[model samples]
Structures are given as structure tokens and as C-alpha cells.
Target: MTNPTLALTLGDVAGIGPEITAKALLAHPELREIARPVVIGDADAMRRGMRATGFDTDALVVIEDPREARNDPDTVELVQTGPSLADVPIGELSAAAGDGAYRFVVEACSLVRAGRADAIVTAPLNKAAMHAGGHDFAGHTELLAHEFGVKDYSLVLSAGDLYVFHLTTHVSLRRAIEDVTVERTTQVLNLAHGLARALGRPEERIAVAGLNPHAGENRLFGDEDADVLTPAIEAARERGIPVDGPIPADALFPAAMRRGRWNLLVACYHDQGHAPFKSVYGDDGVNITVGLPAVRVSVDHGTAFDIAGTGQANEASMVLSCVRAAELAPGWGAVVDALS
Candidate 1:
């Protein structure tokens, strides 16, 4: 089979997205062997990135279609999506940069849906800038979910052997508590199972972290664990998904990371998963959107405006994101069908 073609969206041009993207390709030339990466953004912005990262100036080639990409190690294939963002101020938020980033994703979604691209590997986009540009979405996860017309999706943080799925993301703490219904929990469980199957581990163990401390400590703290979560776990088990939990958040993550008790984990909310994962994994982690039609992986870090143009942004996460996307692209169809 041919290598999967990936739409590599260079996110907020005003931030470190472009720099890291250029640097990832430059630093990891072997990425071309596994996937054909087509940059979906303004050509000038990518040129700026190549220059900022001291990349090969003569290597960038703008193609009219994704199929035209050569996946050459020395040549960076680009599919310009919108008007020039060459002059967008680095290290500062620009509505143009935000809109440009949004457009790049939209174009990528179009390509994926049309079967022109097999997956999407994204760099970070500034949410504030995207909102300022009038996109008014929560972030990349919500935006891509909307573009794909899917309501049952979760923001998943993945490193080697460990995957953390969030039940609620980009919401207030109170809202997060309110959103963790049994139905949503079950859906996320299935999504996690689907991810396991996609990764060739149909019997992979899954675990859920409690919403309250000590897993509500037998209802001394809160009833969400016993009342809301237990039923969902039971339902997942009945469906033949090997799962466990409503374990205390404090213990679940530590055991999962240190002892390898479980490979797939479901966190009740954003910080529950993000804080610990980011602390432990850092640039080694990549963000994934579960329940999309095609695989979408992103750098776990954010748009670093403080070091936007410094050429110091580490591309480790970006490189890993691309590699993960490529790895998942082959089996992603089975995942989507299972979710459906």
C-alpha cells in the first residue's frame, strides 16, 4: 500500500506554528518515507517559516493538489489555502493569522472528506486569535468536530503506550461536571475502545478516573462516581469492552504511568488529563481527536507567542504528531465505522 497523504496545517502564523512545522520536516526527513505531508496554508507564511528555521530555501514547492505532492525529503510540498500572511506580525495575535489558521483547517477537512488526504497533522493555533478573527469556537478540537459534523468526540492526549481521553474539555468546571452524563461517558468509553482497536489492541484495558477525590470515597465526597459513572462502566463491560474504574484521579494516573496498569484512561475533565499528561510527557505527547472520520493529530503544546520568531521552538511534539497521524491513518477507517 502507498503511504498515507497528510494535510499538515501550519497553524497561527503569528505564533510558533510555522517555525515548528518547517523545523519538524527539516529535522526529521524520514517522515516523508511514512507519509506524504502537504502543507495547507499560505505560501508566504511557509516561506517565512523556512527562512526563520534556516531550512532549504529552494525546497518548497507549491502544488495545485495533494496528489501532486512528491513526498521528497529535501522538498517541502505546500497547498496554499488563502491569501498571503507573510506580513503577519510574529509574536503578536493577528485576526488575519487566526482566520488563516482556521482556513487551513477547513481546507484540510475538505481534503479529508473528499478522500484527497488520508489524515491531518496540525501545529498549534492561538484560540484567542481565532476568536478575534470571528471564528468563535472553543479551539481546534471543537472547530474540527464542527467541520466534521460530529457531536460525540473527545480530546485525547497520546504518548507511547498511554492514551488519555477527556470527557469534558474547554468548559467551566461546573459545566464540566454537568456535562459528564452517563451517555457521554459511555460514548467516550466506546471511543476509547475504538482507538484501542485502531491501534491493534482489541482487548486493551481501559480505565476511568473519578470526578471527585478518592472516587467520592464511597459517597462521602460526591455521588457522581457511584451514581453516574458506575452505570456507564457496567454498560461498557456488558458491551464486551474490557474496562475498569471510577478510581480516584490521584491514583489512576500514577499507576497507569508508573506501573502500566492500564494503557487507555478516561479523565473526567480537561485538567484532570492535561495537567498530569503535560507534566509527565511534555513534548513527547500529541493531541488526538477521537470520533472524527479521519485521524487528526496535533502538537500537545500551544502557540508560543513569547518565542514565536526565535527559531527555538522544539519540533519534537510536531514530529511525533505527524508520525502518529501516519501510523493511525491505515486503521482509522475501522475506528470511524465502529464509532458510527
Candidate 2:
């Protein structure tokens, strides 16, 4: 009975991905107590990260196979996955960096699918760089969905007691509004509930945000929030989901996040949730994908290319993301399996 292993994938090599991944494992020794962590990225790039970030390269032990990874707090296990990114420059986008980042994700997912790893905590990958590399996906979620063969999934941003689930992400605002439906709303609520339960919080207070100004103001501003979102919340409450509102988008976040009125808030679209969440939580925000059987968590920010090699990048998000993934991974499979 071994502890579940976590495949920690490095994001964009040319960015701050390698540095943050290294710092997360090094700074947080508690991570070793929960799971066997193995770095899934380019070895050369990691060595460069250590040099740039003033980390002890000797502490990063390169292993030829994932099975060789150990739960040793003193050393970080490295299992190289992608092609060499030696030519890729820091603080800039490169097609080679994109390809490496994409490869690390695919390899990490493969490890989980093969049962070699139990969960994955990914660093940020540059979307434009990956597209230039010919991966041709919008973001990590799309690629994960394609690899895992899942159609129903949601992205959750969590920090402290506040949690937000996006009804639509990585899409245009026009398309995002159209994508919101009764089915998607109900599905995301269940997923958010499952995530809270997996973290041992079963009370699961749920809040639904309005799509219009002040929740349509009784259809004065718009009707979609009342016509579309209200029905979904009503149905959920009838099913005993502990749900409430079509609250005003502006007021809902303040009440839920700052006032502690709710545990989860379902946003109508991307920026509506992300803007406030990131503003308040800053570098502490963590993105958790709830529909997959395996726990998947990631830093809420993107590749900070401008500060990539300056050692100025904050690894707080990375540290929190890994900590949450390890805490949730043990029972995540069972929770998701039961939901399925």
C-alpha cells in the first residue's frame, strides 16, 4: 500500500514554470508526506531554472523512470519527458518552449492514465506558444478533456473559503453567454459540491451569479438571468442541493468571499469570476478541475514571461496548488467515481 504519486508537469520552459515547480517542491516539505512527487519536464531546463533561481541543483535528482520516484523530502525526483529546450530564451515565447510544455502535459496525463500516477499538479503553459507548436488547443482543460475522453468538466478557482466555478472559460464573451445552459449550470453545481466534499466540507453552500446588471433587476436590465439562470437554481434547490440566487454579479462576490455567506459561487462567464477572484486572492489562487477521476490542480496565473528569469516570480500559487492536490488526491477517485 504505497502513497499515491503526483506527476508534477513543468509548464513553459522559457517562462517561470520550471522555477516555480522547483520552488514548490523545495519550499514545502509537507508535500512529500502526502504523495510521491516526480517532475515531468526537461532536465536541462530544470537545471537552468535552478541556476537562475538560486536553488540547489544537487537536490534535484534525475531518475530514468517514474517508478524510481520516492517520497524523500530532501530530494526532488526528476523524470525527463520532453525534448531539449536549450535554445529557448527566457522572458520570451518560443515554439520549442511551447512544444516542450505541451509534451510535459501529455506525458503527465499518460502517466495518470496508465495508473503510474494518482494525480497531476500542472504549472502554467503559454497558450499562444503551444498553438504555435501545433498543439492547436485553446488551453490545458481542452487538452485534458480530449485525453481523458470527458465532455462534462468545470474549472474551479479556490482560495481560502472562497470558491468560484466558471460556466464558460477560454471562449469569447458572446460565445460564453450562449454556452451557458440549464444543463451546464446544474452539472457545474454538482461538480463543485463533489470538490467541497472531497476536501471534507459537505455542507456545500452554493450561490449562482446573474448574467445581467443586478440580476436583470426584474427584467429591466435583461431577461437571461431571470429566464435562464433562475430556473436552474430553483431546480437545484428542489433536489436538495443547498443552493441559492441568481445574485447580482457585483454584490455576490463581496458577500460570498469577504462576508463568508457562501462556499461556492457559479459565475455566468470567465472574467466575471476571474477578475474578482484574482484581484482579491492574487498569487494564492489555485485552479482545480473537478470532473476528472484523478485530482488535477494548477496555479491560477499564466506564464509570467516578463519576470521569467529574474527570480521575481511568486511561487505561492504553485505551492498552494500542489498542497491542495496532494490533500485531495487520496479520496478524489472514490468521490468522482461515486458521482459518476
Candidate 3:
């Protein structure tokens, strides 16, 4: 079989997306062995990133089609997407940046849907910039969900042995609370369990974090944990998933990460997972969205507007994302089927 081709989307033009992606494609020399990577972004933006990141422009091979790409580490294959971003300001948010990032994602998605690419490994996009560009969706997850026409997806982040799936991400705290319904909770747990199996870990030890302090202290803090989270965990167990919790948020993650007690941990909200995950894993992390028609692994970091054009951005996370994408692509169909 041919190597799985990955459509790598360059995120917002104003951030380190292009710069880091350019650097990452070069940093991992074994990437070409794992999969063929075709960059999906503006040619000019990529050139700017190459210059800023100190990669020779000759490393980039501009291609109009995925079939034109060759599996060669010596060249960075690119399929330019979006409007001309040659004059767009770097290190600052702009509508052009937002629209440009969205264009790259759409093109990559189209390629994968058409069977031209096997998977997508995205760099970060700014939600504000995307909104300003008028293509408003919460973030990549929501946008991908909409494009794929499925609501049964979940955003999962992995670092070393720990995996976190958010129950409510990118919403107001009030809305986040309202979103922690038994149905959503059960669905997310199911998604998380499916994700573990998809990643080749059949021994899935899943943990659910409580929404309230001390897990509502048995009704002292709040009732969401007992009222919503508990039933979901019970239902998942009934479904034959190895699951446990509504454990106190404070005690749960530390023990899991340090003690290696669980393979998957479901968080109540965005920061509940992201905050501690970033703190411990930092640049060695990857974000995976499970239950999509195609496989997607992405850098867990955001658009670094501060270090956009400085050639100072680290590509470690992007490298990890690509590595994970390559590892998962071959088995992704089984995952989509399991989640679907």
C-alpha cells in the first residue's frame, strides 16, 4: 500500500502556525518514512515562514495537487490555499489571517474527503481571528464537526500516558455548566472510550473528573457531579467500558498522570483538562479529535501571535502532532467506525 498522505494545515497567518509547521516538517527527518505531508496554506505565507524559520526556500515544493507530492523529506510539499497573504501583518490578528486559516482547513478537509489525503494534522488557529473573518465556529473541532456533518465527536489531548477529553470546551462557564447534561456526559465518555481503543489501547482505564469541588462533597458544593456525571459513568460501565469516577478534580488528574492509574480522563470543562495538561506536558502534547470521518492530530498549543515572525517559536508540539497522525492514520477507519 502507498504511504498515507497527510494534509498539514497552516493555521492563522498572524501566528506561528506557518513558521512552526515549516520548521516541524524539517525537524522530523523520519516524517517522510511515516507519511507524505502536503502543506495546505498560502504559498507566500509559507515562504515568509521559511525565511523567518531559517529553512532554505528550496526545501518547499509548491504543488497544485496532492498527486504531485512525492514522499521526500528533502522537499516540503505545499498546496497553496486561501487568498494572497503576502502583505498580511504578522504577530497580529486580522480578518485575512482568519479567513486564510479557514481556507487551509477547508481545502485539507476536501482533499481528505476526496481520498487524496489519508489524514490531517493541523496547526493552531485563532478563534477570534476566525470569527472576525466571518467564518465563525468555536474552533477547529466545531468547524471540523460541521464540515464532516457529525455531532458525535470529542476533542482529546494526549501527552505520554494521559489522555483528556473535554466535556464542554470553548463556552461560557454558565453555558458550560448547562452543557454538562447526562446525555452529553455519556456521549463524551463513550467517545473517550472509543478513542482509547482506536489508539490501540484495548485496556482502557477511564476516569471522569467532577465538575464541583470535592465532588460536591456529597451535595455541599454542587450537585452536577452526582446528578449528571455519576449516571454517565454508570451507564458507560454498563456498556462494558472500564470506567470510574466523578472523582474530585483536584485529586484525579495528579494521581492519573503521576501514578499511571488511567489511560483516559474526562474533564468537566476546557481548562479542567487544558490547564493541568499544559502545565505537565507543555510542548510535548498533541490534540486528537475522535469520531470524525477522517483522522486528525494537531498541535495542542495556540497561535503564538507574540512570536509569529521572530523565528523563535518551538516546533516540538507540531512534530509530535505529525508523529501521532502518522501512527494513527493506518488504523483510523476502525476508530471512525467504532465511534460512529
TM-score-based ranking, best first?
A: 3, 1, 2
The sequence of per-residue lDDT tens digits that candidate 3 reaches over residues 121-225 is 999999999999999799999999888888988889898767799898999989999999999998988888777787678667888999999988999998898
Task: Name the regions of candidate 3 deviating beyond 4 angstroms.
Answer: 199-203
| Candidate 3 global CA lDDT score | 0.87
Q: Each prediction's TM-score against the native?
A: 0.96, 0.94, 0.97
Write model 1 residue lDDT over 1-340, tens digit each, in one string.
Answer: 4899999999999998888888888778999889999999988888888888998668889999999987888888899898899889999989999999999999999999998999999989999899999999999999999999999899999999899999999999999999999999999999999878877899998999999999999999999999999999999999999998899999999999778899899999999999999988888999999988889999999999999888899999999999999998998888887777
User: lDDT by residue for model 2 over 1-340, one digit each (tens)?
Assistant: 3566888898899889888877778877887776788999988888888777788888889887678886678777888885678789998978898898889888989989988888898989999999999999889888887788887788889887677998999999999889888888888877777666766776778889999899999999988887788888888778767777889988999888778888788998989999989888888889987787678889999998988987777888988887787777877866686457
lDDT of 2: 0.84
TM-score of 2: 0.94
Clash count list over all predictions? 0, 0, 0
The candidate maximizing lDDT is: 1
RMSD of each: 1.3, 1.8, 1.3
| TM-score between candidate 1 and the true structure | 0.96
